[model samples]
Target: MGHGTENGVGRRAVLRGGLAASGALLVPATVAAPALALSGRPTATSGVQSGDVTATGGLVWVRSDRPARMVVETSATGSFRNARRWTGPLVGPDTDFTGVTRLHGLPPGEQIHYRVLLADPHDPRRTGEPVTGTFRTTPQSRRSGVRFVWSGDLAGQGWGINPDIGGYRIFDAMGALDPDFFLCSGDNIYADGPIAATQALPDGSAYRNVTTVEKSKVAETLAEFRGNFRYNLLDGNLRRFNAQVPSIIQWDDHEVRNNWYPGEVIAASDPRYTEKSVDVLATRARRAFSEYFPVSTLRPASDGRVNRVLRQGPLLDVFVLDMRTYRNANSPDDQAHDPQGILGREQLEWLKRELARSRAVWKVIAADMPIGLVVPDTTEGLPNIEAVAQGDPGAPLGRELQIAELLRFVKHRRITGTVWLTADVHHTSAQHYQPSRAAFTDFEPFWEFVSGPLNAGAFPASALDGTFGPERVFVKAPTASNVSPAEGYQFFGEVDIDGHSGDLTVRLREQDGSVLFTKVLRPGLVGQ
Candidate 1:
């Protein structure tokens, strides 16, 4: 019980100065700090994260540059020995000074070692520096084998955070693939893209960015969408890949604009918003995306629903899908009998009773769009339909009739290790679907893959809606369209799941930790 010696500073020298002020040795910025963190003792310099991890529990984000007093403690080592605390809250700017803090029972596949101090909300022992990190829970033994990594668009189009190409360094190649959870299958943030301090490439060089002023515009209020999630936590390799990865987040439509739905109305040929009601900018981008990620279905009197089901043990469960908040309204989607399509209708019957009560032998759906591709939402050029295939090849119309009734209820409830995984159309592919290349052949042949735009802007590969008869086998986009990330199509995807051969293997990486495609899948399969 001794995190002792605060002001005298020596509890392993405040754990080696909070593990060198939150590891990955700081070297970048896309910050939005209105200054003010000069020692009234409550800092948290935007780092120290952890999220929906499970098999006991997790969730430990942080923010505090001003109205502090978060606590978080946990410890299974890292000299934080005998740790175990929680005590958070009072983060200010009404949560733009974030703060998540959940952590529970813990100890189900060990290795936690957390930290995060902040104090001084009127002197909580006047704390200040302390920021460590670690994660690795989720393993109620199934012979214990599982790895994770998934990605999504980030800093899109006019890509932000560049620090001469190290900010968001593909999260240091996805935190050196030490995966166990990272499924951020959605444009984590791009709030209608607008980051410019220079991005002029057409082979004429220049790409700078590390800009601010709430990303130089286009994220309608709520403090510019909480400064677009504090500008990707001023990327120190995304705060050391969010202090060693644990995320499982989901959210699409540039987190609030590009292709937004639900009573949509910001179209004056796009005026970068005067809050032109896309439901008041998606209720201020879902309250700054529920105060910046740490989703367990986003609490705080819940209703920030990102459609849950992470589950990760008995060999995986994922299912994330909130395909842009219960869709329906970007249409050219030929409706036949739309059931509020695009996963609306109680999230498509709670993803069909949680994929028939998954016992987890894979299941992974996690899609934030990408069901037989298509995706076109042209906006005043009119022919809409953003996601869930509406370039229809017959049968299943609009939002492909809720993915053709959840792939005909997982091929009539035989739900055998279903696979899907996604990342909006920004390149990287692999499809398989198959009902023998037909239209609506009641699901069963599966495998979706797709990677990402982790460092954003890399399109050119989306057009495959033969209504559930996909088959692209593999593709690597970027011949044209948005391309930049220094012109090298960025991406991420990894899955591994074998604990005694339940084989799930999906590696489709790139952005330097190359491994373009690798499929495997044979865990109670229905399609080889």
Candidate 2:
């Protein structure tokens, strides 16, 4: 089968079988746009992105409208007159025509410009218009400062691509910040939330979604799951933001369904996916996620989980946790001794070892869900199960035990400058967890900053569990659902690390580019 040719196979078959012909080939520079235009296939519709940046390299991503041989040219200048060329993986039907190029040997702490060129996969003689992007590699010196933004929840609760309003304009606002990278905390897509072309607004106005056949229903098949990732790219603002700002992306429950776990079965109440197993759905979702995001962390480990660490220079180390992959089913009766608590044994051990071994001045835990927040899973007509916690006001219980153990380990290891950043709560808050205020005081004090719902419903603040000693320092939440970004509650967090002093500054900002709260902590003053 030729690349871009859709054989009569179903979506799942295409996903599984299309990778058989992924042979890497070089393209000639003589390839021109006119020749590709004759093929009548759309080129790069989703725009281009660069991500997973390290001191010496980064990953560049692009999605072609058809199967194509991907090429990336990098230069220090915006003009690619003397650029270095690199070949990306073959983009075929297996990955929904999306591919990532690993750009290595880049100069650290310097702005690097790149252009993505797609040629005919079979011919390699016809080319499409090149998409341009720029990113800076991590600084090799610990004396260089670092800045990045973090947020989550895209197209959730029926808030999807609105072409009329320029599709997720918050991204444009975030882009203006000019951060080095974006840490997508979780809920990158809502495969469970089907979007209609037109939705009725509260004031009798109509909100329009740039809908496709794939996004009109809950995602089940591989193609539908891939469509969930494609749906956001329809937004020009998101595309523009992605081009300039690299991303460190992760996923939470909504990537498959709200609060779904490994063994849960789809219920009949959800007409779109009745009687389906969530694990099967997650398999499809995970593949689509890995295909779309540029992060190598999406590649599963030997144990089939996506938990890893990213250390940028000696200033900061990010421990990205995979809370969804190894979690037990949500239930109120989850016990402290349960082996299937959120992080799983293997991942938790890896995290501890990574943290203790790190020499960076700052250790930021990129948690998909907050430690103390009460996340209730009311799916499948089941009683409200504690997805991450049981909301107990006393000692650690259930999943809390796992978190407590991790915290105690950190304390015992004397891992200073350790902080937590999370997003699943749909609000922005600054939380201070002090041992003196906790029922269990074995752990050292730390700060947890919560911000999210890049384009989704605004929710009220979740109640904190007393087990971990979380005290809300500052909170910005909405009382209603489906709140538009225009209302200005949509949030993203920013972190800036000073190289010379090793001071970290955290800022929570609103969708309108206004700062809601700011805090600066020096190296030795973490718990204070």
Candidate 3:
């Protein structure tokens, strides 16, 4: 997969055919070859990705199999005539051989081409054939229009990359739309869900997974967690998608363990794990998460928090929330005086302040879990609640109190053009919250869109808690639980904000790129 193109265009340039193209987001290269044994050229098999992109800058990532110097070069076009060079880190064992470089001074709304080279530390001349990528910066003008795709829950419930089905075909479908970016709404990796080589499908076919050592079991150690991130790069479709789309990533429960929170210990009865402390595992997982994704705020030297506002020009400002990191333990969720609920106190305040300060046409809140979805905890059984809602319909209780407080604040501030997008439930649905129909009538009406499972098991839509009076306008879910990808029901959502008219359209699409549902909202409206 090294420099398959002659004139210096990326080998993946043929991805115009999208899913049909044989190009990979990452193709396995021989990264561990002896340094001085042969030609001594360093290799980067993990491909390349860019994320946390803004109008002026972005971050690029790559992994080397051996000790090598990371070097990045960028160009306005594919031609490397007047490229700018940036010397990156010396990627080695300390960070698991992965490195990220920040790219600055990029022009807004224009496609910037780049290439990554892994060079021998001693000699710059000894370098691997470059891996190339391209992405457009966020537009500075409101009239430029903006569009992005979102989904979550990858390789969960025992599903992994299936080479028989083109290895994450959903990415190819999404990449075809040419979204400005991708909002990966958490559950980016399933540290607790181990994948097998092959399994029989109910439809008389077999699900053949592209297996890797890291994806074989629950990740506990730091290396295993890093492997969990690298495991997804084995899929050519996903690798291609990463090369094309810059992602705004956040993590949910699956990245560390199923339904995990701080200070929680795995029950001893679950013998699959020896590491009982979820905190220890989470510390390791968080480092790996920071290393893997290119979040501007979560860089290695930074404070490493997921809650930040990404200003996408004048049209959109995405408030990425980390509901997993800072939260009270999952329980019956009925505490009447709980302020440190799902979002904790600090992140909740930050979100509220950011929402009030956003001057963009739309303020899209990206929540890892749905607000009103009744996501119950199956671990250790009983009445433990996993997400925001706790099934009580009467008054705001437990984590619902935090959400109610935020909604009330929004109402009092007269904040308009707000919408919520999430995807932890593995189904596609839309809800319109209205005060007139509500038990809690303090907040103004808004829309929440849920879509996902991207390449994982599909479950029935979770029961909606009536705390915010969210009416399910549309829902598409499987009747059975944990439906395999072979049986269909995989989904992703698209948001297209028209520049001239300022009408935001949301489309829920399936794995095959079929639009399942659509909702349109105006910019200056109190409600849709």
Go through the candidates in order and give each one's C-alpha lDDT.
0.78, 0.79, 0.85
lDDT of 1 by residue, 183-266 (tens): 888778888777877878897888887676777778888888888788778767778778777788888888778887889887
Compared with the true structure, what per-residue lDDT tens digits does model 3 show for residues 240-270? 8888888999889888888888999889898
lDDT for model 2 comes to 0.79
Clashing pairs in 2: none
Q: How many clashing residue pairs appear in each of the predictions shown? A: 0, 0, 2
RMSD for each model, in Å, please? 19.8, 9.2, 5.3
Per-residue lDDT, model 3, residue 127, is 92
| Model 3 lDDT, residue 171, Cα | 90
Q: Is 1 or 3 the stronger prediction by TM-score?
A: 3
lDDT of 2 by residue, 1-528 (tens): 000000122111111110111122111111123333545543886788887899889889998877788999988776577899998777776678788888898898888888898988767777788888888888889776888899998888777766556568787678777788899988899888887767676788877766767777788988888888887776667887887788888888888888787898877666767538998999999999988888776543424455778778889888889898888777784575766588888888899999999998899999998888887766655665545666777887778888888999999988898989999878899999999889989998999999987988778788888877889999999787557654557899999999889899999998767899999988977476
- Which regions of candidate 3 are displaced past 4 Å? 1-39
Rank candidates, lDDT, best first.
Answer: 3, 2, 1
Q: Which candidate comes out best when scored by TM-score? A: 3
